[model samples]
Every structure is written in structure tokens, then in C-alpha cells.
Target chain A: MDAVLEADGLGKRYGNRWALRDCTFSLPEGQVAALVGPNGAGKSTLLHLAVGLLRPDDGSVRVLGQQPYDNVAVLPDLGFVAQDTPLYRDFTAAELVTMGGKLNRARWDASVARNRLAQLGIAPHQRVGTLSGGQRAQVALALALSKRPRLLLLDEPVASLDPLARHEFLQALMGSVAETGTTVLLSSHLLSDLERVCDHLVLLETAKVRLTGSVDDLLGTHRQLIGARHDGSAIPGVAAVIRESHTDRQSTLLVRVDGWVDETRWTSTEVGLEDLILGYLGDHRRQGSHAAWGVTA
Target chain B: MVIEFVLDGRSKVNTYMQLVQQVRQALRVGLLESGDQLPKVRDVAQALAINPNTVLKAYRQLEMEGLAEGRPGVGTFVTGTLAGASLMHQAELRADLVGWLRRAQTAGLTADDIVALVDTTIRATLADDVIVVTHT
Candidate 1:
């Protein structure tokens, strides 16, 4: 599959501090990818860079095979819902749809947006400011989908909603993707939600891309192993020891494997997507980036 | 089909496997008849808030198991049924299995040891007739 988005050593800094640096990954077309990380990990920065809202200070990013910074050709094919699903509080849902139609006139499908709002029982004339958080998010999502863009970028779209609302929002998002096959990059901290809707995974830590791949492949290749305590060195046949804890008598290690492990010496168990990420994130929380420790090399 | 799939978030089982198990269960209970059309991929994805690819993967697994078949441009349909008189003995068999498990536990076998023993015995006993799918 062709990559919808690609970055190479992408970096952006604010003043003396780097918000994102040495970032690199590619999102293939037709995959709903999850952009996840700890706070201040530059998720929003990456989204902004992708949508042309901000330019990278180092290296580059490509959306639909070209630089997106002020690139009008790629803008029409890209739809973005910034954090908080922001909209004009004064305008009603209908007016917002009208504005969206005018903004993307060539590709906008008004009726689809109208039908979606109607199905959700959101009145078209209802003011955006008065709508509930979930309703506003839905309206924003409807408008984004109405544009029928080839790629959709959502930044923490469900972070503010309650669990039920989050579920409904993901349902709607998946429903639209089912129909249109629109490639989506949704940044979120909810692992369970991502497990339901996303096929691809990207983990950014301390402003760098730590891991990126298909969710199934990632889950399949990673495992949790428990065994007698051993030296904190390389284990034969294991690709990388993602994290390891040791006591005087026992060791527990989360590792990436290539269909190879010393079964006789280790009791291995498969990890779910959530645990897999938590393992990596836990390691980061303890030792910062695994890169600095050379765990991945 | 008269069945709606539900997901258990904390089950530790693969999502697609949960879906497949649900289908098998519905078939075992006679809720999904041989001719019944499975839910559309889009419908399932929307209803369950899961990726369409996951739903497609589950349906493909069903097809592989000879329990269902998909028609181009249409949807998947059940083609096999596991419902039989054996289901009538489920209660009795379950009681005996529970008793055996309790006995094994009391006799100093850990859960994993009992599972391995039962699994191996089952394989040794039904080697030619069954394909064992051990769940953790």
C-alpha cells in the first residue's frame, strides 16, 4: 500500500527546547493509525505539521507524497479536526456545514453531513456553543467526513468525552471508515479505544518515534517472559528486551521476538495491544527513552 | 443471524477470536442457522465500535473453519452447524469435568499442570477425531 503520510528525521523546536525531534514513520493508506505517547510527546505538533498548520524546523514530512506546509494541492485531500474539536460557538450546526461546504466546495457532500447529524438527533439549527461536548465532537466529525478527504487527522478527538460518548464517537468514526476506506491518524491516550478501531500503531516518546508498525504484527511479535534471574544482557533469539525487572532469584522481561525464544528457560505469554504499549510506556517512564539505553539497538 | 456479538475488554483473548467464539457459540446453540446471513462487516464495525478489518478477519476465520461462506457483493452466510444431541449432555459432562478439575486441584496439581495434563490426555485420547484449541 502507498504511504499516505511519511516523515524523515522530522523535528520542530520551540525556543531552546525541542518539542519533537528525529521523528520518522510512514502511515499507509487505508489504515486507521493510533498516534500515542505520554504528555508533551508532540502528538499535536505532529498533527499540526501534517496539516500544514506548522512547518518543521528540521528535516521534513510528506502528506499524500508531498510537503503539506501551505501546499494547496494536498490540503483539499486532507481533513483535520484540531484538539477540542473547535468550532465557531456562534454558528449553528447547519451553518457550520454550510461553511464547510464553501471551504471544500469541490468535494464536500452536504447531504451526508446533514443525514449524519439527523441520525445522531443533533438539530441543525442548534448552536455549537449550546451543544453537548459529544454532540459538538460528532458535528465536527460529520463535517470532516463530509469533505470526503482521502486522509483524516484527528487530535485527541474523544479525550474530553465520557466513556459512552467516546464509544459512540469511535463507532461513528469506524462506520465512516468502513464506507469510505479513508485513512485516519487519530491521536489518543485510550488504549482500549485504539484496540477497537486502529490497525496501525505509532509510539512517540520524549518527542521521538520509538515504535511504529501494524498492531497485529506488534502484538504477535512481543511477549512477556518470566524466568530465573540472569544478567541484564542480550538474550539469544530475542530481538530486543523492551523492559526487564530482576530480583535475586527471578527475572521478568518484556521482549520482541522473531518466532524464537528459549522456551525451556522462560515462561512466555502473549501480550495484548494495551499491555504491549504499557510495557514500552512503563519502560519510558522509568528510564526515559529506550534509545538512550540502547535497548532497541 | 439471530446473534449479536459482544466484546469482553478484559478477556485477554484476541478481539477477532472473541468474535469467532461468539459465532461458534451461536451455532452451537442453534441461534445461527446454516442459511442465515452473517452481519455485514460495516454493520458489525459500527455496532461494536471495531475496525472493519477485524470483522473481516473474524468472518474469514469462520470461512476457514467451514462454518460460513461469503458471496461476492453480498455477505457471509452460515454453512455448517455444530448443534447435535451431544449438546443435550452438556450439563452432565460439565459437572463431571468440574469434579475432575476439583479432584486434580486437591491432589496437588496447579492450574497449569492440570491444563497440560488434560490437554495432553485429550490429544492422546482423541488424536484422530478432534482438533484441540486450548484457550488460556
Candidate 2:
């Protein structure tokens, strides 16, 4: 499998503060991956690095097996949708899409763009500024997709619209990916959404990856077990007991168990992605440790 | 293509779900067809101004339910043939409805009360059906 994105010992520093440090991960072509973290968790920094928007202080980054920054040949193969989603608000949707076609050296499929916009119910003749925020977003996205890039990088792509619009937008986006085979690296704060679209998840905190793997594998390894409350002191087979909720007769625990627990007494259930994330965040807070990263079993 | 998701205006359901439900309704109504390609996930995420991941989750669930499929190298697509999903989906929907009905029963609402509530709402909606007004 060819790697669509790769990084090694990646670090970014702002004066004395470290935004990201020793970050390492690679995503192959035909893979859809998500980067997840709390606000200011260096997710944007990582994305900037991957897309060649910003250079790293140390280490290297690549997109589609080539250096991403200012590399014209590689640039045409990639598409980027930023957080602010800048657009020429004065231009009409048709004018904006046409302008994108004129700017890109690669073939810009205008008909595809027009059809996609129409399917989304966005009027091509409407002025971008007069359009609603959601409609403006659609125009910008149409411009990006028109370019038909192989690798797409997006930062907080859907942080604005109302609920129904959000669903329509995502359905459209995923539908495109399924059709065009574009590999995407998306950064987001919504774990449930990530659980829905992403096969692989990269957990970032303090500028480094804490956990990275398939959702199924992560859930399989981490189990939440509920047992009789009185024997709650410590579980003999677990790796690390992080959180515990107890009652008079029964106790539920979030524990990192070593290997597998095939025991009948323990009612085991797979921990959700959100639960695992919250546990990671909570553990980070409790250790009183900053600038340190650890992957849970 | 008969996709349906819950949308509660004031309940604890998140906004992204409302988005999901509406899309499902569109599919159910034939507003979006089997061969129709959806907008890119990022594009939709950007338009709705919600988390891309939430939208992704909805798409993924739809895929798992066989209403959608994410073709490797291609984008996500609506299933051309929904015939394969009918039996499994029927069982799943039944189980889900049973769970909800059980909760309604526990809340002290009788079946008669529920039926009466539906009847009144339907009557109010149909009251203006015979009225005609001039067009501008």
C-alpha cells in the first residue's frame, strides 16, 4: 500500500512553547483517517504540516510520497479546505467555480462541479456573499472538489451549519469519497462523528500521538467490566484500573485489562471511543504531567 | 432507500442527528436517488458548519445499515438495490420500536392515549385542506 501521508519525528515550536513534538504517523492511499483531540491539542498544527501549509521545526512530512509545500507537481494532486474556508464572497457561485477552473493547471471538470452544486441545491447564479453561511460553504467545497484532487485535507470542515444541513453535507462528502476514491485526513473534535466515518483514529495530546489504530481494534482491547461491588479493591487480571463507579451491591469499572478476560462473572462490554477519549483526557489531568505522551493498552 | 432517522426539536438529540434524519427523509422521498452521488464529507461538513466527524458518523451508520456504501478508492454511495436490506432492517427497526414503546409504557401513557394524540394532531393538520386562496 502506498502511503498517502507520512511524518517522522515531526515537531513544531512557538518560541518556548511546543505546539507539537515527536509526532509520528503515516496513512496509506485509499485510507480515510481522523485526527482527534481537545481544543488547542495541536490538531491544526499537524494538519498544516501534512498539507504543507506550515513547515515543521524538525523532522519531515510528505503527501502522496512527495514533499507537499510549494511543490507544484504535488499540489495539483491535493485539495485543502481550511477552517475559515476563505472565498471571494463577492463572486457568484458560477463565477467562483469558473475562477477555480481557470486557476488550476490540472483539468477542472466544470460540468461535474455544476451538477454537484445543483444536487446540493446551491444555485450557481447566486452571489456568494448573499448566500447563507451554509451555502457559502457549499460554493467553496464545490471549488475544491472541482479540482478532483486525489488527497483531500480538511480542518474542522463542519463547525457551522444547523443539524439537517450538517447531515446533508456529510452524506454528500462521504458519497463523493466513495465515488472518487479520495483519501482524506480530517481533523475534528466530534468523536461520535469520527466513529461514524473513520476506520482509523489518531489520538493527539500535548503535541504527540497517544493512541493510533482501527476503531474495532481499540474497542476490542479496552473493556469496561461490571462485577459484584464488594470485590472492587483491585482486579487481578487488569493492567491499569483508571476509573471506578461503585454501588452497594455492584461496581462498574473502566480498566485497561492485560490480554483477554473470558471470565463469566465479569460482564464485559466494549468501551466507546468517547469513553476512551475522556479517560485519556482525565488521566492526563491527574498525572500532573505535561509534555508527556503515553499509549494505553 | 427508505432511510429514516429521529429528529426531536427540543429533546437531547444533537443537531448533527437532525441533519442525518433530514437526509434520510430525502432518500426516503426519492429526492436523492440510488445512482446519485452525495457531496464530499468535508463539503457537507463545511456547509452545515458542524463537526465533520458527526456527519461522518451518520454516513458510516447508514453504510452499516446497507442504505449506503463507502467504496474503497471511490466515495460513499447509496445502495442501488435496497432489496438485500429489507429483512435485516425490518428486524432491527422492530427491536428499536419495541424498546421505545416499552419506555412509553413505563411513562404511564396508555396505547389509547397515544392513538388519541395522533388523531388530534392529524385532524388539526387537515382542517385547511378544502380552502383555496388567490395566487400572486
Candidate 3:
């Protein structure tokens, strides 16, 4: 099967400013991928392009083996919950679900939506405007899941939710993915949340992709070395120096390893997901350039 | 069955590694034994709110380490034990070790110092065995 989402040289511009430029990444099917980046790094722009909310100015994007926009068959297979989870304020939970069923036609599963709402403790008669933020988000998620989408694109769905609510929402989401094998591409600035749920990662910065890969593979290939740092010129297997800091007596280097290094020289420690992401983000910020650390593209 | 998996997301340790370590630790403490079925991947994933793939990877790692095995259409099961001694013997040894650790703590040894001491002792014993073999 092709990737769930694929982008090649994807770029999007607004007037003179480039919201996203030269972005390219392929998210494999059945993987929960975390799309993370700093504010204004085009995270949302990339997601918008993927879901066909906006078109790319330069390159092309494919969602589930077809162009996202204007494709009759593809639209039903793609579910999108925008950042605010835009829902009709006056519509009750049941009405919103009915609307979803009407909008999706044969594709919508009203029973699934209604059951999810009831399980989430959302009363069917309650107006969306009167629901709590978490309840509203749950209703939005129910609508999305009711479509039975093969690919679900979430944009900071839990950014405003409290910790417990966030946990509950993710629990529900993962349950659906497990049951239905839904491919999730969730964009969030919260690294901790991503760390818990994401097996794949894509890091964006300055409107470009800094890194993307399986989290396990990335963590296995990166190492933190704290020892006498002497320019790192003699390190034979260092793929890239992701980040480097020095003191008068010692040097710390975060390096992507392509092969074995002389372990006797430094204490090599394992790198975690958050540390790896922060290292790339910090490097991009300090250098103000897209230095692809371990990213071939 | 129904292993209560705990994950420390904030720790520097990789989550999968943490899972692998937990399974091994459980075996060592007799909490899990041979023929004990591990939770289904989806069940653990939903319970922890983590990706099912992560749970699958951890289970695969355990299988690689010869600690677990996955039966087709059936759930994964613990296949090997980490503890070398009999359960009664292990309990006695554990009690002695705990008593020794308490004494070491009372003697102003930090947790790091205790770990270092245990690690160095094990390494030194292995080195002695190697020297003995070479001389023989």
C-alpha cells in the first residue's frame, strides 16, 4: 500500500510570506505520527494542505493515494478536526450527529457517533454552545470518527483541554485507532503528549521539515556524548552534530550516529524523544537554517 | 494476563525500553511466570493511551530477548524466567540483599554509590572467571 500521506517538494505561500516551503515527508499507513514544530513554523499549513483546506503553491500532496481536494471518493475517507473543532453553536449533540450523517451520506455511522457521545457523558439534548470545552471536543471527535475515515488529521485537538480531559480524549482516540486501524497525523506543540502516543515523528521548523522518521529508529541512532569535545572532527561515525555545548573542562554533543564510535572516549547515553526533538529544534533556532540532521531529503 | 504496565513519559529513558525493562523486572520478581499471557497490544495501548505500534514493538523486543513469545491468533506469553534460582531461594536472597542495602544506606551510601558498587562487583567477578579460564 502507498503511504497514508505523501508530499513532494510541497510549498504554500500567502502573499509574499511563505507559510510552508519545500516540505516533504511520507507518513506510512497505520502509524500514529506526531507533527511538531515551534509557533508559526507552518505546522498548521502543512496539515491544511494535507486535508485540502488549502492548495500548495509549488509542489503536490497526496492523501491515501489520491489528491485530497475535489475527489469524491477521497473526501469520505479523510476526516479533519480543525484546531478549534468548529461546530454549530446552536446545534444539539444529536443534531450535530444527524448533520454529520446527512453530510456523509452512506459513509456516516450515526450509531457510532451517538454511542461515542453517550460514552463520553455528553447528553444528546445539550447544545454545543453550552457544552464544556472538553465535551465539545469530544463531540467534534465523534463526528470525525462517525465518518469512518481511513486517515484522521487532528490540529492541536487537545491544546485547550485540561490534563485529565486531554488524557481521556487521547484514550478515546487510541481506542478508535486500535479498533479501526485509523492512520492518525496529529499536530501538537505539546511534546509530552506526543511522547506518550506517537510512534512516528515529523519535526518542522522555519516552514521546512527538519526531521522525520520512526521514533524507535531515531532514538536508537542518536546518542548523547559528554566528554572532552575536541571539534568532533576526528569522530569517524558521527552522521551529524545535532547540538553542541562546551564548558572550560568538558563538552557535550548530541550526535546522530551512522556507525560505531570509540566508546572509550566518551560516556554515550541514550537519547529520548523529547531530547531528540529539542536538540533539532534548538539547532535550527540557533543556526537559523535547515540543517537536516539524519534526514536524507 | 492484564499486566499493569506503567510508563514514565518524563524520564529520559525511551518509552519502549521502559516497557521492556518492566516486563523483565516483573519476571525477575516472580510477578510473571512462564505461560502467563501478556495483555493484547490494543488493550495496553488503549489503557495507556499510547500507540498500539509502540506496544507491539516492545513485545517484539521481549520476544527477541527470548523472554516472551507470540502465538499466532493468540496473545503474547512469557516464555522464559529472569530469575535463575528457585522461588524460595530467590526470596531468601532478596531478603539478604534488602538488608544489605539498608545497611549500606545507613552507612551513608547514596543510591548511585550502591548501583556502582554492585555493577563493579559483578564485572570484577566476570574478570576473575576469565583469568581463571586463561590460566587453565
Candidate 4:
């Protein structure tokens, strides 16, 4: 599979403090990948680096196998919607799309923008500033979709919207994905929302890549086990212990199983996507700097 | 397609499995018939706001089960009818089940409790080399 985005040893900082460090992940083309982490986990920083809004302070970042910074050649194929769905507040939807057409002349289709807004009941003449948050977000998404880009990077596009708005936004996004087979890497905190549209997962914690893989593969590899209290360090077939809790006579562990688990001795059950992610995040908090856990999905 | 799937986000069932089960249920109830087209993959994905691949996976599984067939350049169609002999007794069984559900509800079982009880009983009943007769 072709990599839509790639970063290696990526690092960034504000003044003396590093916002992101040692970050690395490759998102394959045509995969809707969920980029998740707590606030200040460098999700926005990583997205900026990929979208070429800012250059990395160290190492490298690539989009469509090319350095994205100042690369006009890649711009036509890449679409980005920054946080808060940024748009010129003064411009009407009509004028904004016309401007979008001029700026993205490579393959811009104005009808894609027009039709979407029309269906969404967002008037073309309505100034962006007067539109509700959801409407403005839709306009931004429509403009991005009109570019007909092969890749889209959305940074918390639906973070502020209500539930219905969020659903509508995702519906439009998924529709575009189905129609064009566009590769997307969107950052969001809504795991349930992500669970549906995202096939790939990239977890960032404390400025590092905690886990990233196809959701199906990750789910298959992780399990929750309960049994008599025992330190999880030497468990056979367990690739990594993500989280563990012990009582006087019992222990519960979430593990990444690389081989077969002895089902006869311990009760092993499947881990849902939410459980798998929370386990990793909790494990990271406890281990801090020197995480011995297997960091890959 | 006559049936439109509604997803329960909180359900423990996998999304694709839910889709497969919905289609099977539709078949058993005569909602979907032979030669009826399944909703297009893009339509279902867009409607449900889910990944297109998820819809494709469900369709693929349906095809694997001989319940559906895909035509190149055309849409998937219902190829197998699960309205078998057992389907004739479906109404009778449904009424009996409904009565039991009402009693269970009055007996103070919450939805989750009822689901757990039924699921455990099903597993215990279906244990060992029993026949797969409860196919619907």
C-alpha cells in the first residue's frame, strides 16, 4: 500500500520546550485513520507538520512520498481543514468557493461545493461569519472536498459541534471518501465516532507514538485476562502487558497476545477498541519516560 | 432494499456482524426477498456514517454465506432466502418469546439482565455437538 503520510524521528518545539518529540508513523493511502491523544499531545503539531503549515524542528515529514513544505505540486492533491474550521469570516459561501476555485485551480470542482451546501441547507449568499458553527464547518469541508484532493487532513473539525451536527459532518466526509477513495487522517477525542469511520488508528501520548495499526489487527492481538494473582511479566504467549491490576487472590491484565493464550487456566476475553486504547493510555501514565511495554499496535 | 439498518452504537456486537444479522433477520421476516438488491455500499456507509470498507466486509460475508451475490458494475442482490421451513413457525415462536419477555420484564429484569440471561441460556443450550437448527 502507498503511504499517504509519513514522519520519521519527527520533533517540534516552542522556545525551549518540545511539544512533540521522536514521533514517527506512516498512514497508508485510502485508510481513514484516527489520530487520538489528550490535549497537547502534539496532534495539532503533527498535523501542521504533515500539512506543511510548519516545518519540523528536527527529522522529516512527508505527504504523498514528498516533502510537503513549500511543495505546490503536492498542494493540489492535499486538502486540510484546520481546527475551528477556519474560514474568512467576512466572505459569503459563494465568494469563498469562487476564491477556492481560483486558489485550487488544479482540479477544483465548484459544483461539489455548491451541491453539498445546497443539500446541507446552507445558503450560498450567507456570509460565513453569520453562519452557525456547524454551517461554517460544512462550508469549510465543502470547499476542501471541491478541491478533489486525494488526501484530506482534518484537525478536530467536529469538536465543537452538537451530536447531530457531528453525525452530519461525518456523513458528508464518509460520502466523499466513498466517492473518491481519499485517504484521511483526522484527529478527534470522540472514540465512538472514530470507531465507525476509521479503519486505522494512530495513538499519540506525551509527544510519542504509543500505538498505530489497522483496527482489526490491533483488536485481534489484544485481550483482557483474569485469573489468580500473578505478576504478568512472565506470561507465555503474551507479547506485552498493557495494564494490570492485582488483589490478594486475583489479577486482571490487559495484554497483547502474540501467540496462544492458555484459555484453560485464565479467562481471556476480547478487548473492545475503547478498552484497548484506554489501557495503553493508562499504561503510559504509569510507566512515564521509560515505557517497557510493546509500543506498536 | 426494503429494510434499512439502524445501528446501536453501544452494542457489544461488531458493526459488520450487526449488519449480517440484520440482513438475516430481514430474510427470515420476508422483508428482503430473492433478487432484491441490497442497499449500495456507498449508500449504507453514508447513511450510517461508517467506513465503506465495513459495509464491503459485511457484503463479502453475506456473499460467503451464499445469502447474497455481487455483480460486477452492478449492485449486490439477495441470492438466498432464509425463509425456510423453520420460518413458517417464526410467528408462533415470536409470540411465545414476546410473552416470555413480558413476564421477564415484570419479574424486574433490566434490559441488560434479560440479554445476559438469554445469551447464557442460548450458549448452555447450544453447547456440545448439538444441531444448528435455530438458524433464523
Query: Chain A of model 1, TM-score against the native?
Result: 0.94
What lDDT tens digits, residue by residue, belong to model 2 across residues B6-116? 335344344555665666666654566576655556666444433455566777877776777787655677774333335447667889978977887898989998678
Per-model TM values vs. the true structure = 0.85, 0.66, 0.84, 0.86
**lDDT string, candidate 4, A113-145, tens digits:** 999999988887889999989888889999999
Please provide, for model 3 over A76-98, each residue's C-alpha lDDT reduced to its tens digit, 9 standing for 90 to 100.
99999999889999999999998
What stretches of model 3 exceed 4 Å from their correct place? Answer: A232-234, A287-297, B82-85, B88-136
Candidate 2 lDDT tens digits, A52-115? 8787898888887888766777878888888867788888888987788889858688876798
**What are the per-residue Cα lDDT tens digits for candidate 1 across B83-135?**
89887787789899999999999999999999899888988889757876676
Chain B, TM-score, each prediction?
Answer: 0.63, 0.49, 0.66, 0.65
Error of 4 at A111 (Å): 0.6
TM-score of predicted structure 3: 0.84
- Number of backbone-clashing residue pairs for each candidate, in the order shown: 0, 31, 0, 0
Among all candidates shown, the one with the greatest TM-score? 4
How well docked is model 2, in DockQ terms? 0.05
Ranked by DockQ, the better of candidates 1 and 4 is: 4
Task: Name the lDDT value of residue A159 in candidate 4.
Answer: 97
lDDT of 1 by residue, A1-297 (tens): 499999999999999899999999999999999999999999999999999999999989999888999789898889999999989999998999999988897789998899999999988889999999999999999999998999999999999999999999999999989899999999999987888899999899989988999999898899999999978777877988998889999999999997678899999999878888889988856644778777873
User: What's the true lDDT of residue B105 in model 3?
Assistant: 100
* Fnat per model, in the order shown: 0.77, 0.00, 0.70, 0.68
